[model samples]
Target: MRSATSKARFPILLLTLLVSISAAAGEKLTALQLFQAKRYAEAQIAYEQLAAADPGNAETHFHLGLLALRRNATDTAIAELERAVALDGKNSDYFAQLGSAYGAAAQAAGLFSKAGLARKCRVALEKAVELDPDNLDAREGLVAFYRQAPAFVGGGIEKAYAEAEEIKNRDVLAGSLLLAQLATGEKKYDAAFATLDRVLADHPDAYLALYAYGRIAAESGLRLDVGERHLRRCLELPPPARAPAHAAVQWRLGLIAEKRPDLPAARAAYAAALELDPAFSPARDALARLPKP
Candidate 1:
């Protein structure tokens, strides 16, 4: 009984509806299952299909964004996550994901010498926190993003330090560690030392803080002795932490020894690092670079 125009549109409408429903069901099941199983690539495909079928499905887009993030597709993740947030403005998780996507993009941009992209990352992260004040992950991401981003790109060391202090008052050691990293980035060597000292004063065996301190020292080029001490302490920590710490410390020590032309010590350090983490590429590379003894 429909007119010709209606008839033509009717089939298309019906087909669209059917496709949407099928895609939704398939995406809902496959995305969740695959995501939970850590099959992010497959999950991304399913989410993409659903997003294509129903562009208004914010959750599907969000999942696709997360999947892209897992695969290190920062640009794709940003586009998908931004779409997801636009479609569902009230979802805190969407904002958080969007922020993380921006942060990833910033990291990629830094590698390519695109400062603007890094600034955009900070804006996205700030918006995420504004949207979800209680989201610890979002806050942590913001702090980390800011710390890694250049000062000229809205990532001042002072700001990072203040944020860390705020987090510490709230009893978040992880955030405090990130703040210390910011201090290190700023070349506020004394400030960095004080921040880590405070943290270690309260929790001396905090392996994460110790590791961060070691990394800061190694990179800053101003505190080799202090860095070496922190790294050694990290190695003394317990269990899984000890393994990573040992690897990192040994690698750094190997570099120091290499600089000093102490080939034997460098070789020993590199070997020890590899023993702790056989897959540590940096240590392996260092070993390769060492002079034959």
Candidate 2:
């Protein structure tokens, strides 16, 4: 009788173990799905629970970091991403995101702390690239940093160009866009337009190219009508992952409308931008600055 009872308990215990393992995996999937769906608040809670349950889980911390970053909680993002990197130093993505968080923190830091934070940001990004040379996001971050940072802080337009060339070698569209952006920054409007025109000719419906073209138009205040038309066309396209959000395109529309001196249209465009993303400070600020209706 005792032997029979022991055999019954062994099967029950094994089943319980399998169920627990399945539940843990399901939790991870559910949390990831929530994050991908942009249900960030819920995803944060779910990740926090997972972190609590499995404190060693680097993935959990990484997701939590990304969610915090989305909300502009840079401090929390840095902390969580740091944990992720500490747990998995070999992961290029973890280091890349940690670098981004560090960059954001540097931007918000006061003058005294800014340099140190920026250096950390650069180091992490460089490490990420070293770990995986094919990481476009990491390479893009390096390009942006090199383009924007002063020479003293390891920024150079030449370096930016080199990185853009590297990207172009891997992905023509992204590289062309980055190079065009670099040209735009230097007020080389013709060169910028020429590059973008080539992209548009090849991929007429590419939303990113359209948006980039519209952005240059808005920035230079040239070709307003064409820019507006292209931007409106961007709104009609399906937003793909990693592309500029609709809020950004709407903001550009507002800028173009303002350039046209169409006050009402500008106001409407800004309001539409805010409606899509209330946290979009540029749109919010622009809307607030308009004369009270």
Highest lDDT against the true fold, candidate: 2
After TM-score superposition, what is the CA distance of residue 49 in candidate 2 from its true location, in Å? Answer: 1.8
Cα lDDT of model 2 by residue, 20-115, tens digit: 999999999999999999888899899999999999999999999999999999999999999999999999999999999999998999998888
Provide the overall lDDT of each model, using Cα atoms, as 2-decimal numbers: 0.75, 0.92
Any residue pairs clashing in model 1, and if so which? none
Estimate the TM-score of every prediction.
0.72, 0.78
For model 2, the local distance difference test gives: 0.92
lDDT of 2 at 71: 90
- Number of backbone collisions per candidate: 0, 0
Instruction: Give the per-residue lDDT digits (tens) of candidate 1, residues 16-119.
Output: 99998887687688878988899777877777777777789888888888888887888888888889888988887788777777766666565565677767
Output the TM-score of candidate 1: 0.72
